[model samples]
Target: MTGRRVAALAAAFVSVAASAGLAIVAPAAAAPGCEVDYAVPSQWQNGFTAAVSVTNLGERVDGWRLTWTWPSGQQVTQAWNATVTSSGAEATASNAGYNAVIEPNAKVSFGFNGSWSGTNTAPRSFALNGVTCTGEPGPSPTTTTTTTTTTTTTGNPVPGDAMAQVEAMQPGWNLGNTLDSTGSDETSWSNPRVTEALLDNVKAQGFKSIRIPITWGQHQGSDHVIEAAYLNRVKEVVGWALADGFQVMINIHHDSWQWISAMPSNRTGVLTRYNAIWTQLATAFRDSPGRLVFESVNEPQFTGSSGDAQNAQLLHELNASFRDIVRRSGGNNASRLLVLPTLHTSSEQARLDELATSIRGFNDPNLVATFHYYGYWPFSVNVAGGTRYDATAQKDLTDSFDRVYNTFVARGVPVVLGEYGLLGFDRHTGTIEQGEKLKFFEHLGYYARTKKITTMLWDNGQHLGRTSFQWSDPELAAQIRSSWSTRSGTASTDQVFSARSGAVSAKTITLNTNGTTFSGLRQGTTELVRGSDYTVSGDQLTLTAPAMTRLSGSRAYGTNAVLTAHFSAGVPWRINLVTHDTPVLASATGTTSSFSIPTTFRGDLLATMEAKYADGSNAGPHNWTSFKEFDRAFAPNYTTGATTLTPEFFAEVNDNARVTLTFHYWSGATVTYHVTRSGSSVSGSP
Candidate 1:
């Protein structure tokens, strides 16, 4: 996720009529009119964050001043995107220099964090430039009212059965980071514009659907009018997918965070903008085939709301409004599949239940429920020692799927795992080992299949090289494609280790047969006799000591030989025959801003690093966990034979405090090192 600045507000007070030529002096027939939306998105025990949006409805203004009185005594602590000052229960917010000019019917918004006591009731009335706001738009010459009338067109009719249609959309793919890029244009994010060849390749790759996420805010003007060129361009891409016989889903992507997130405080303005965007979209695609799906808002979440209850209600309003607008647009949209997501697209039981209630209330058979899964929280980002697809990680996956399935699928509601992949994969693949990632995908595919839920792979140009139209890791891709229909045989560990300096011993691996019959093992083209080289008893496969020694010829460091374990069905399992000994670390000294420990890997691979204080408390970044996040707090450079402690790690550590560093290797070896920070200088010892 990209870092977002914490919005703040500066203290300022300006008289509404003080500015020369900026006074609220309008003709008798055309007095200034405005709309104000006050929202409280986040609230804690005694403090909360509130957002205010003011729309100049009657006349254009070069400078603006808005005043409101809080029902309860609330003190503004901080704010952003505007200047805010308070006296007693009265608050005054004026536009900042950059956003001072508000065109007629255009909105400017600001937010602030404040402390409150007793009842924190929102102010019922607001005044902009000394004129009371009506909380509704006033007539403006630039306002263009669009009226949609039913028109017949030649195209495939929408399918009546939404379940069947969604079923056909199995194994979907997202055209991510392109249109959804929060930049000036689709190519602004560096991903090439949508091409027919791209859709062709996606269809050829066995994906039945493509989720083209489009951000409309960047291309929208006053009254949230989408640029026709951009709209036609989006239609062209959707047409390409539809022409290729692929089910297409287009959505309001980053706009959810851009403006829709302010719905709680700016309900009227947000809804007005949201409705306009959808009305235009629905009207444009009204004649298209039912294969086109409309997701109300991508991961609808609100700020300036009291809590989850308010957030849920806000989402329901948006979803309901979207459904109503689309249905009223006529044509095939009346029966088109409308997809809705839970708050933040979460698969939690409570969120699922909330969505379920809304679905039942809608009682629309053409609606589908959706959520996103990026594996478990820890394993998703390779944090808190979640470097492997262990039981905890696996359980998190299964448990999440089970909840969504039971809540939606079991009740005759089709579910779409809108996006699925490791969260760390977004940073770049290889954060998790190749084998662990493959296992995670394989399990997810099989489980989603069994649960009868369609899954969409979220690719932001990382998994698949968009230019080459090829997967970066073909082996992992093969595992994923194979899991769609059948289960694959996996092992307890993909690696078998042998000491580089000692006599080799027999190594046993627990195989997850997954209903697949085990065949003989092979090294390159030579097949090994089962009894001589290996023995399989039930799920356990053991390699003979002689075979291990021969595989590790001369006991070389690192991987000596690669063996493939063949199965009767599904993809073959890869076993790396590695030879390694305990790793060694040496003391070093450097400034607190940068530090690295010289390491002798001795063929071992670094797994995770743990930092702790003498008092046994977690140290460094993400102090709640002893194991610091990989790639963020620390990173291993095997090529340089060194493990680096990132500056971010040093930023939070206490000065003059000795922190214990424990480096865990993949081969079950642990090496301890200690580092002490004194002002800008740091020193380490093994």
Candidate 2:
């Protein structure tokens, strides 16, 4: 996810361990009327950045002490706040200020930059204020360091050799009907359902890779367009893959025709949206480390794959477009390899010896060209009528793909087989019988590495042996078994933010298929919010925030706010509106959900729904993606005897000639409390 899509700000959160499958090895303990809850940055890799947070669990927690064990290989080189005293792998810290006593259930947070081996795990054990805390893993930590290399071509390549690198990460499995309805190519591609449970099964069996050939076009406009809703949902699934620490490959999938068709005639516009999509996704995962990648297009076809000339022409254009888009995104995306399409994007005689150079401007160091392998019709296909099975054909097919990689070695470009599968139009399960499939897969796995090529089997998950894809039989067991056993690449992971709908048409408030409203979510009762800058009218909410943020080319992450309902409570509701790393201010149990407010980023309330019937099951624990933060006040105006607002802290103030107000903290700290002349909380909370 890191790439040109990386955000200027870090991914934000208070306690993300639950969402991340992380356990706080030690839960905090406290005296009656006195409580303390602590947190680390949402990202806790084996890095140099050190951070810790302590919240008064009950009464005010004035002084604090924290202790924990660091992972063996990672050690702290520098630290701040309290002090770092370590022995072997254990460390402890004591707060310097007595007032640092976190007030009642109030919270105080701190951090220091550090480094690690790029894995997601946290420090274990902790003693708060000299008292042994209970949780094993203390808290979620923030991420440190971002990989930002942006070279598009290779550093060292054998001249005249051609290379392609497919982002082959999905495990090999037959697809189902839900994926492909037309019985067309879209059918059962890596059915997440079947493959979801079978991933470990396939990996254990020896399958090295799986290609989730998703046909997103079905969800797009008739013109083969992509909708934000569909994209977000896809991201959710991708998130699951990443969390599993699996090597995942996400591309335009089968919507090549629609997606490529939308590519701007000018590389700028196309690159703009290209970076936009990746940026949104990347920013969400910037802090989490992983081996996931974005493949530009499934199979680009500017011109049909009629012959070599057309194939060459299409590849040239795709190469140019792919490079242009990669360099614009930042973070890991800067240097992460991007897979480009071959001329016809398909393997056919018409595409013999066809390839294109790495496009310029994409010199981010990690770019790979790609082509598919299938050869001619009947020979390439597993038709029920095609004589019997052909093991030799399968081997040759694998060799054909190897040829594409050979091309890369000659051209010095990293290349991969974007796709390779066999099927006949005749019988549903006719093409490439299960036995032939086994041979095909065996040859593929054997030759893949030498060819220096990565691959994705057209393992559409749902249908399987029911149709053209026949991986269900005993003969194909090894294919499935091997795939179940042997995995490729690295499977590191980090959490990613997911906005229900990435983009919404301006002025829309339905929260229907297009609009993704933040509702049906809260720790206790729920409240409503409007859009980014709209006001709430009855049940309708609208937002009023600015379109752009201080961050360049990046708009604010959360666009909805509390427009309608508010929470009372059994459990405190966690909220997150800003997509970047979250900052912990103060958290308490007694306060109502309505009492929580916001800062910089804003959200709109659509409608808040809460069902607190005794019979109703509590959401138990949850996280809020709302954009809310408490407002901090400034120093008093000297001569005017009035607190002055600097342009830095200026509010539009609606030109009321500026009515004055005081700033206040919920714990009633000596801090001045204030209400706007408009009767709004200083933090802008209603």
Best by lDDT: 1
Task: Give the true-structure RMSD of model 2.
Answer: 30.2
lDDT of 1 by residue, 139-226 (tens): 5534523310111011112334887988999989999889888888888888888788888888888999989888899899996889
lDDT values for all models = 0.80, 0.38
- How much lDDT does candidate 2 score? 0.38
lDDT of 1: 0.80
By TM-score, how accurate is candidate 2?
Answer: 0.38
TM-score of each: 0.77, 0.38
Error of 1 at 349 (Å): 1.3
Lowest lDDT 10-residue stretch of candidate 1 = 5-14
Kindly report which residue stretches of model 1 are placed more than 4 angstroms away from their true locations once superposed.
1-160, 426-430
